[model samples]
Every structure is written in structure tokens, then in C-alpha cells.
Target: MTKIPRGTIAIEEAVLNPDGISWMAESATLFNTGADPKKASSHGHTPQLLDIHESRLAKMDAHSVEYMLLSLTSPGAQGEPNREKARKLAADANDWLAAEVAKNPARFGAFAAVSMHNAEDAVFEAQRAVKQLGMFGIMLNDYQVVGEGGDAEGKKYYDAAEFDPFWKAVEELGVPVYLHPRYPQTKDLERGTRYGDRKQILGAAVQFHLDLSMHIYAICSSGVFDRYPGVQVVCGHLGEGIPFNLWRADHWYNKPVKKATRPSKEDYSYYFTHNVSITTSGNFNTAGLKFCIDQIGAERCLYSIDYPYDTIEEAQDWWKGVDLPADQKEAIGRGNAIKLFKLPLEL
Candidate 1:
């Protein structure tokens, strides 16, 4: 029953377009086996995810969330087979989200969804979203699926040379791309882990973050930051469990069995400290948050309520009860988010 501090900002909340306004219908079709991928993906078209009216505002007020940074639900436009289709979907989704944010600018901000299937279109859409639509930043749902129909085998990673233009665009745009998690169906199939089979269990809980952590590490190891030091990447769920095992990864990198020329000048931890940030989204573990703060410092850690997935009340209560100084709590609750997203708050 602890009261949330005033002016708290909640990033990483998701929205659902139940009336076929955005790309949900098309993108949901990609996962043919699921029970209406939209419902399966977002715990069904809940009132919270679909509501942008008083219902949503009421929830925010109840939780003392001043602003909520919203994005499209998972596998959004990223899993589309056709690049052109993906481009259109991304544009439509962003446009819809922009309109929603425009309604209540004081209470809502947005993350642009770009078509990662086509690098050129992705850059163009990102530019349009940030420059024209006035989105706070971009949110990529894990890795992108590349290739034509029935060719969902190919995948796109940010660290690859092919994504250099996209990375360069992000750096130039000066907007942090929140690297959010999506379940890796291909990995589940290859490893026979049944993540895809059990959407209720593995999609959000296990395989999603695991797949994203590897992608995050790939970006770190592949020297993406070395080339574009200005760009910032964000990982949710307590660094996707990355901060806890940095020493082991760094040690292995320092003494590689098959040593070769490395792309990055320093190790993964260096980039994490310099160019990466983590959020307490969907993860309310106080011990984990303390460990992450200890590892990366509170300045690089932000707070978010994974709305509709985790209640804003729950997040607020947990954050309120944490055994930290008021300044440190404020940094995690609002200051870090404002600094990272460059929120134009009048405070």
C-alpha cells in the first residue's frame, strides 16, 4: 500500500489495435499455428491494451504514472514476409500510434516501429517516425525475419554489415532503439525446446529474453558500438540476464581459445557501461534491480511497467518498497528515462 512518488514515467507499455487499425491482422497471420496470434501474443485483446481513452488514463492515474511510452505489441511488422508489406505495416502502425499519442501528449509518448525486413525502408520509416511524427524513440521487437513467403528461415541481426546503414541512421537520428524481446520460433525448433509450441509459457517468460540476450551480446561482440559510438541500445528484463554474468563472458573474451582480431577495442562490459541501458520492465525483482544498478549504475537503469502484462500498481508498489535512497529511486523512476529518451518535461 505504498504510495508512488509523483512524476513517475513508465516506459515499455504496449497497445493493441482491435479494430484492424494497425498491422495486427497481417502480422498475426505469420504465426499460422497459434490461436489468433494477436490474442496469444498480448494475453488477448484486453481492455487495457486496446484502450486509449479514460480507461487507460485512469490506470495511469491510479499508478501515478505521468507518462507512458507506448509501442506496438510483439512480432509487430517484423515477421511480415514481404518487405513492402512490412514497410506499409510499420508506417501504418506508427501513424496510428502517433495519433494516439497526439490525443494526450502530456500523458503519452511513443516508440516508432520500423520495418527491419528491408534496411532501406527501415531507415526511411525511422526518419519519418522521429522527424515527422515526433516519436521519442524506436522499439524493435527482437531480431527481424527476412526473406519471401514460406522463406521465414532467414533472419536479420543489427551487428551484420547489411544493417550498417540502419545503425548509422539510428545514430544520426539520435534516438535510442529499445531492443525488446520476441520469442525466437526458429531457435525453438532447432533446439527442440518447444517454445513455439507453448506460446503461453516460453514466448514471454523464457525463450524470448534468452534469444534477445544472445542478440544483445552479438551486437556487443560484433563491434556495432565501436563503429557507431553515439548510438544507444536498451535491453529490458534486467539486461536480459546479461549483467549478472559479465565477468565470465569478459574472461572468455580476454582469453579466447581461437584468438583472432577483434572488432571491439574493449570487452562487452565496456560497451554495456558506455552505450547500453537496461529497464526494470516486466521484472520487479528487487535483488535483480540492485544487482543491475550495482553493475551498470542507476544512471543507466530505467523503470517501466509492462502494462497489461504486469500491472502498473504492482510495479509502482514494488518500486515504492525498494530499499534505496529517494534520489536513486527518482533516477530509476523518472530521471533516467527523461535523460535517455530526452523527454521534454516542463519540470
Candidate 2:
């Protein structure tokens, strides 16, 4: 087995605030037909999610993770229905996360949570989070679920033209927006038709990536990356399975008819490989890791634990046992994230 490297970084690790603790529970109701508020709030990972100090650090130390980039557990500010309230929650969560990172800057960094309810507000909060709060990156919890009660207008994906300013702000701030997955019950009819009985497949099992990749692919196909080529986007769970299937999609898009209708200037793979970086967050299979490296290269892959949701030790152990070259491993474990995020750390 390979030994642990020093100062390895884990992006996509989750943290929460006491005031905003109920957001996850509320999210389950919005997106999970089977969500029990009690069970969702009191899930086994609750302690880890709220901890910013000793316990989390101990886990990192034991598992050889030198630092973590934390964000609010999903479906965060993005899932909130009330637009004004969502904006406030985003500001509050980012502020709290900043304070947490201040407690131990060496062992922790954080991503800013922004409400996608209104593109204007999202732009404002994202700028403040990066400039004032000192967050390393921004997090958007998939598509923003907009509207109140059953009147929801459905998801507002960032790929829309109105969000060009938000993308511009991120590019100017020079921070990657970590697009994380959320539960898939965004629509009752869709949930009932497909993932209805099998609740297990709806969350992280299958639906999370299935739903998220649509939005990611939307951004790839929507000319956002082409418009703002400086903007970088990070996705977890092995590019939400994009790396595995990207070649086929890119192959199909070569059709003159398809190309004529599409908005992007380059192939899907072009935006994907150039603008996107994926992390080894929850999907810890060594073969999957190798396959992803073959598709996207190790420089675009970052090592991450997806902490609290997935055990830290398991992810670390998987990395230790991966059959990859040492330099590649070094890049994935530390160098890539260090350079991409411009992390101020020494390994």
C-alpha cells in the first residue's frame, strides 16, 4: 500500500450552522418523498456535520487528510423556496463557515454557499463570501428549487443567460464553483414515475448524479464555459459519471444537425476537460479512479473524502491502495487542488 502524503486536501467535506440546522431536513421534504424530518435531522452523520473542531480534526489526522474545504451540507441555500430568506441564509451560512475556518486555517478551508433564487443576489453573496469572508470557493447545490409550496416554478439552472453576471463574478473572483449533488424529489410526478418505490436509489445511490449531471451537462452545452472560459467548475462523485460517458456524448454531438442546434462553440469534451475538475469524493472505487484518470487525467482530479456523509477512513484507505503512479497520486492528493484553488499550504 502507498503511504499517506503530507498536506493532502479534501474538498466537498460538509459542515453546518446551529441556526441553519433545519435546512437539510426541510430539503428532504422538498426533494425526498420518504423523508422523515426527525430521521433526516438526526441522521448518524449529524455530529460530524456540525463539528468544526476536535472530532473532525482527529478524523483527518487519523486518516492522513491535512486539510479540508468545507461547505454547508446540501441542498443548502439553493433548495430554499422563499427567495428573500434563501438569500439571507446563504449570507449567514457563509459567514459562519468563515469563522469556522478561522478557528483552524491550516486544517480547514471552506466554500461559500450562495442562494440561486435570484441571480443578482447570488452574485452579491458570492462576491462578498470570497472577498470579505475569505472563502476559497463557492458551492451551488445543483439547480435552485424555486417557488413556494406546490407552486414551485421548478429548478433554476445556472446555465441560463440571466446568470451570466454571476458567472462573471466567479471568474473575476477566480474561484471554482463546486457544484454538489442534492436529493432528486424536486418534482412529485417525476419522483413517483421513476424513483417512487425505490427510495434508496434517489439520493446518492443513483438519482443524485443522474439529476446533477443534467445540470452539469446543461452548463457544458449552454455555452457558459465558452462565454467565460476563465471560469472553473468542480464536480464531485467522479464528475457525476461524466468522465465515463463523455466520449460517447461528444461523439454523437458531431452530427451536423445537432451541432447546428447546439449553443456551445466547442465539443462537450472540450468544455468538460478544460473547465471542469472532478474530485474523488464519495465514489471510492480504485478502478473508477483509474478510469477517471484515463479520461480526464490526474491533474483534473482532486482527492476528497466527502466527509461525514462518507467515512473519512474509508476514503483515505482507498486512496492508499489505489494502483496509480506516485506522481499521479501526488497530483491528485495535493498538487492539483493546491494549484487550482491556490491553497496557501506547504506539504
Best by lDDT: 2
Give the alpha carbon lDDT tens digit for every residue of 319-340 in model 2. Answer: 8888889899889999899889
TM per candidate comes to 0.89, 0.93
lDDT of 1: 0.80
Q: How accurate locally is residue 235 in candidate 2, as Cα lDDT from 0 to 100? A: 94
**Of the candidates shown, which would achieve the greatest TM-score relative to the real structure?**
2
**Model 1, runs deviating above 4 Å:** 1-5, 19-43, 149-152, 186-201, 256-259
User: Model 2 misses residue 275 by how many Å?
Assistant: 0.3
Tens-place lDDT digits, model 1, residues 182-248: 7553444533456544555555567677888998988998878888899998888889999999988
